[model samples]
Target: MLRPGSTTAPSTPLIAPLAAPRTARPRRPGLKAAALAGLLALPLLLPATSRAQETTAADASQPTAPAADAGGGETRTEVAEAKTAEARAAIAAAQEEDANDPLEGMNRAIFWFNEGVDTVLLRPAAKVYRTVVPDFAQTGIRNVLWNLRSPLTLANKLLQGDWDGASVATERFLINSTIGLGGLIDVAGDHGLTYEYESFDQTLAVWGVPEGFYLVLPFLGSSTLRDAVGFGVEAYGDPVSRYLSNTHDDWASYTRAGVYAVDLRAQYLDVLDDMKRNSVDYYATMRSLYRQRQNNYIRNGKVDPDQFPSIPDYDSK
Candidate 1:
């Protein structure tokens, strides 16, 4: 009820508002204490959570560590395999070299004997010849010697079925013997008909003959069994040798052979010296070179440049 003179409103509403009855919520001391404790420990718990996350991250990266280790292991395995292959190759090369030089002891003895002869007699003679002979005279002598061997080269070319080479050799011989005045000048070479040396050994090689074992002749620096046989045939069948033999002038034939040897040696002085200077095993080096040269000859000088030794240009010098 409101008094007419009262300035204050009534404490209770005139009509109760339409609403559901409110339930009282009870206070729990234990739940309040637990919440307060959790709040108090929050700082420490945060660090522990971060530590756990770091541990999980490290565990995730662990698999990749093993992958890296496996990669390293593979690299090591490859290196080991490469080393093994190299060792095997070295052993195989050694065995092959040994097989090629079966008569090493005897060959070395003969090689030393040849070396001795070269050192004592041939080398000095070659030096003297080079000093005394003019370059033009040397060229003339070389031409003459090559011309003398033209017939033999032609025969070998024919035997090897090289018709073109035989024809060139015949033309060179005819031109040089007459126009060049017994081959004192290379008129055929001036006309672009270059001389090509051929041997019975090369012919035999073309015919599929094996070179046989490496041999060191008493006078010859290096040879094979096949080449030694070829040399004997050449000596017996040489036109000049035959003519001299028939004329009963054995001394003249010897003189010719001696001069040929000296001239050949003189031409290769620098080349041989370079080889001897650089070689670890002179005999083995010579053997390898001889085989390479013989192979080159058999192939008619058609070989890889890398496979050939550094032979000096006699004409250029």
Candidate 2:
């Protein structure tokens, strides 16, 4: 090489350059490979999750101090507040369950027994009745039954010192009984004269009697002590019931009551099924519904925004 490159200043004698560094290219994993990798990585995440939970619990137990960054502090505060509110709501719900039903055991037993009876007899009978009776006839029967309650509604209205309500009841009864063919038709209601359902229980509530506790009666699903007493009073004072007891057989009123029960159960079968399906706690759900309905009734179906849930067209609907 020196003889060939005499003018090239003698090529550096067999000088070998250093080897360049080599980098291995990373290979992209396929779908199965990636899934397997994720599976392998899953166990590592468990500890992280456990740590997060522990941190959350610790944060919940200890009062939080504001962070140095204003935005971070506000975010932390909001999260802490949300957690606290959730915990408080859970505690309140537990307390309410306890306070709502003092006789929970007895009520539960009665509820089970009632359910059995409905399954065995009432439900079957209602199904048959619904299939046998025409819609128009059933409507007529309901209207007649409603017409019969006019007297009791009137009594409650008078006791509540609602003279105008009493007058409306009287006028509606007279018009329906005479012109509506014994109230097998709703002639009065069709003429824009609406009748509201009032009860002596509502009157008692107006007079400052607290609803003692939720009660589930045999054959009657949901009630309170106040409502049960009012129901008894209404039953005894009902004009049709009294007439049947006085003029007809003593058992006739009871027969009439049974008929009424079957009718109501039939009408509400779908509604009750829906409630039970959607409810997390059927008994509690029914109690709440009954209370809501009672409150609405007491206020002439008005939703008092402060005391009750807002439901448009509640009373009328």
Candidate 3:
């Protein structure tokens, strides 16, 4: 198949040498690149390293941790143990009453101020009220006040989708207000219908709000961020408050509040006194009790008696 004068050899693809694949050297990270990567990762690593160091320091600083054997397994000297003890003591002394309370300093200050007010004015007034008020009359006032809270409870129940609770609250309110003579008696309870009280705070808790932090409010003792917000809701939504405001009876609101505070204080006087007497640290004790009870209430769980180690003895304040 060649032309007579053609000089070109027939190209034989079959016997031709195949070109070798170019071997590529794997490019390693350069020193500068590795350094840059390390630099970038340092922030992420630093926190962990810092935490690790702190933990190690804490461990190293402890007297409880057994020292490595020195030749014949002699432990750390007594001086070392003493130093550790001193450090621990210092830490304990310096630590806040409730580490969980982020606003501990502010809370304690407010608590002291509240205590001053109570000691000066409220306590004496509450004592006088308790002394002068007839027992039956006090009971009646309590009943009426409790009854007034029905609307709040009912609304919260409805919000929480507790139809049965809302229904019960409604029946209780109607029966007590009418049959019990303006909630001065316990007709509802006598008929085996009792309260299923729920606050707007509890409703918020039911709706999956996290308790942000412990707070000791000015007059209101135990609260959290969520509870504070809930309190604002309750304040605005209070039917009695709204009614009084509409009727231009603002004085009634003040009177109602004053009576309520005095009554509550009187009721808790013995309980609080006993708590103060028995507690090594009143602030800490109150914090524990408040958090424990509130948490139980929020979850609709019965409080574990064991959780309250130092129950200085009071029922249902």
Among all candidates shown, the one with the greatest TM-score: 1
Q: How far is 2's C-alpha from truth in model 3 (Å)?
A: 99
The sequence of per-residue lDDT tens digits that candidate 1 reaches over residues 11-107 is 8656555583445334567988999999999998999999999999999977778789999999988877776677677666664754477888999
TM-score, model 3 to reference: 0.65
Screening candidate 2 with a backbone cut-off below 3 angstroms (N, C-alpha, C), the clashing residue pairs are: none
lDDT string for model 3 (54-79, tens) is 99999877665333345224434554
RMSD of each: 16.7, 17.6, 27.7
Prediction-by-prediction clash tally: 0, 0, 0
Off by over 4 Å in 3: 1-99, 301-317
- Model 1 spans with C-alpha error above 4 angstroms: 1-48, 55-57, 60-67, 70-91, 94-99, 304-317
**Highest lDDT among the candidates is held by which one?**
1
How well is each residue in 1-317 modelled by candidate 2, as lDDT tens digits? 55763765665547454573344334677899889989999999999999999999998987556544777778778877776677677667655753478898999889888889988999888888788999999888888888888999898889998999999899889999999999888899998778889888998988889888989999887788999998898877887888887896778767667777888889988898798899898777777777778889998977776562222231311
Alpha carbon lDDT at 233, candidate 3: 90
Q: Report lDDT per candidate.
A: 0.86, 0.81, 0.80
